[model samples]
Target: MGDAPTQQVPGLGDVVGYLDSPTAVCGQRLSVHLSSTVGPTRVRLRALRIGDYQGRGSRLVWQSGAVTARQQHEVEPAGPDRVITERWPVATTIAVDVSWPPGMYLIEIAPLAGGQPSFIPLVVRTSGAHSPYLVVASDLTWLAYNRYGGRSLYFGPGSNHTQSVANRSYVASTDRPVDASGQRTVFKMTLPLVRFLARHGISYDITTDSSLDATPAQLVGQTTVLIDGHSEYWTKRMYDAAVQARDGGTNFAFLGANEIYWQGRIERDARERPTALTVYRQAGLDRLARADPATTTVQWRHAPLLRDPAALVGVGMSVVGVHGAYVVNTAPAWLLAGTNLHKGSVLDLAFGNEVDAQEPPGPHSPANLQVILHGTAMAAGRTKPSLVTAAYYNAPSGAGVFAAGTTYWLCELDSTCPGGPTPRATSGALEQITLNLLRAFAVPRAGRLHPSAATPYESPAWLAKRLPVGGAATGEGQ
Candidate 1:
């Protein structure tokens, strides 16, 4: 919110719009769509690079002169998925050349004739970048929560939209503007981590989930891949690419919880450009499941594809609406160096909203999975309390992976997390832990140099009982 107004207009009835796409490479042209109740409104737009720049929070990159913006009508919802597409004419077009550096950007549109000012977030990616660190924004998740045009994949306008199955869209188009709620998600979830990275002078490349799907090669050869903030939805191509990267010795940091829960795919227009995000909530009943089962948008651990999420992140989602704090259980000297955390020390309100834990009697976790921090929360719609676990593991490929198992990890850095403010001592401890994790993962073949220690459950005595007498007992057989 640097060059843009901090307060957003009340509703979508004011001036609102979105870009033709969420991402762009240098030398590509971007179209900005606009609709306004104030006809012939004088519009002033600017592109601001988003991050913490000495506490200013943003830097102005480009600005556009006054342009005439007119009211554009919205197209009605179509198809069983209730796909909402805005066929608004382009109010302005911006040429993204080498002058604009590659990073996260936002286009601020202000109507001078008295209307609301809106913003369209964009990520400028570079194809040739092979930075030591890469941050992938959860753009797909942002769209999933976007309530623009009166419908989202989850919620709608009235009381009828409150139900999980009724009045929801299976497919949502990117042509519509992101509402105020989606904008708040960016500030609350993603921006704090971005600021922390920038303040630490960590040189990294940033891209969106859709861009990674379009060009998977961008993910290869990176020392570390960091996925931040509530990244619940994933495309098959994106999931496959991440697995391939990990297998090839690229480290990963899942800094947020509830990741890769559901499968989704991108739909394209006749021109072969990505148009809508499609996901069938109840994949078993989907008509497409009869023909192509993989295309169904079921949970990752469900039928047809029984790939459990714990196998990837070392923990599976357990409870939602959790407001507990992380209590240190087994902090390795290497991971928790310089921090005052010890066994049984609690970090105030470090876990909340949603969390993950090791699921027993279900799918198995990765080899040498270590639970460093633990928390407990009352399971949603249930009376029993569930445990939340933050874990780490070293893959056979010599790639290190750590899962935070909570959505509010980064939010603690900038003190923007909901529920309450994190104490200074708690914030410092988490920040140091993050710095240590990032610096370690930035090294090539991190697992080879700093292999994970055996957890209590993976001790020789624990493994001996599960194996044959003469057979060797390795930590890998959990």
Candidate 2:
């Protein structure tokens, strides 16, 4: 399996922390509460701007004098599947100012006492006028899987300290800190994608996950909306805003996979800000909360808001597994452009974690949805093959919707993928294709745009390429 891993060198520092707010607008003041083990130690705060240079990692945006480190938060037993985070007095709330451009910023916190640096993820959002694209961070998913105090929605507190912990926060708050090292995308998807956009000078804005509660309009005037990494947990408003954006002529590029597949509700604080996320992982949860639209929690395709993700993204979540090498299928030139990748091309080991397949072409699923990458997945005991499709479709409003169909899309762009088996050829192909999408989607075209007829469009060849030497199809859509 491919993994995005972190690297460390002597003298160079690394940071491990989370931001109070998942995101902040440019010029807006947001607090960054940093924590460290050593007391009375100076720390340097630097904002590293991600770029495209092969060896050039990032440029420094801002710096700060080292502040004394202290442990202010404590973890304690709360409930079965929760962790209560209590913030104490000792904290240096650094205010992010207007000078910071609207982009992803790596909040590097390095101890002057000589130790590996810690990293806190923060993104400065664009204010007022909309850019070409509105980038969203997968924060809700981050918190959902955060086993900070030893509990997560997946697993409750266990019997021992190593086994489990507990929490009472019925609705977990963003005010609580995330276990930075425990975060998967901060280094894997977020950093690499952000740097890619910056290096290519893509005109874009950014916003956090939960901010969809009060900032659905964040999509206004933007040509494209980009969602990166695992955006599995989504509130109703976030999903609606995306739909509204598509309907309103805003293009979308879901760089991540398994997006908006489940339903979640936002918990508000006294100020009406989203303080927590509530999810029960059952369709019944949404029925119980259907009376109040804000609290509805269920599979998006199940009840109440029975809007299918495949209809919006052109493909819905299906099997969970890996693709040895994503086979290129029928794709428009606007989609393939600079990438030499064409029909019959194989992106070596480019797919993993999870993937989606286009639903049977029908009213709900757009007929225009074209298979960009074709592959298959095996679910352990399943004898039949499940289709893996990276799809693309154009909305009537000239808004293009593309789903990467695999969770590993952005990670493939990460040149630092762990182990010696990095997909060098696959990475380059994905890079140019991403740039092509951004450039093409940013432009307003009359009617919907599709891949040129000059390009070959064949799914059979793709399937044939993926099929084993003498294997035959058990059945279609199996």
Candidate 2 C-alpha lDDT tens digits along 303-389: 666788887887788666544457787756777887887787877766655767767645677777777886765655666666667
What TM-scores do the predictions have?
0.91, 0.84
Global lDDT of model 1: 0.76
* Lowest lDDT 10-residue stretch of candidate 1: 469-478
The model with the greatest TM-score is: 1
lDDT of each: 0.76, 0.64
How does candidate 2 fare on TM-score? 0.84
Candidate 1 lDDT, 1-478, residue by residue in tens: 3653322222343577788888888998999888886666788888888776777777888889997778888787788778899899998898898888888887888776655567888888866656788889888887877778778877655655256447778887888898865665565566667778887888788888888887888778888998886788888888889988888999999988899998887887675567878777787556787788876788888877677878878888876666766778787888899997898787877776667875553446765788888766553465546667788888889999999988878877766676557788888998999999987887867888777764543322332243221211111100
Model 1 clashes, total count: 0
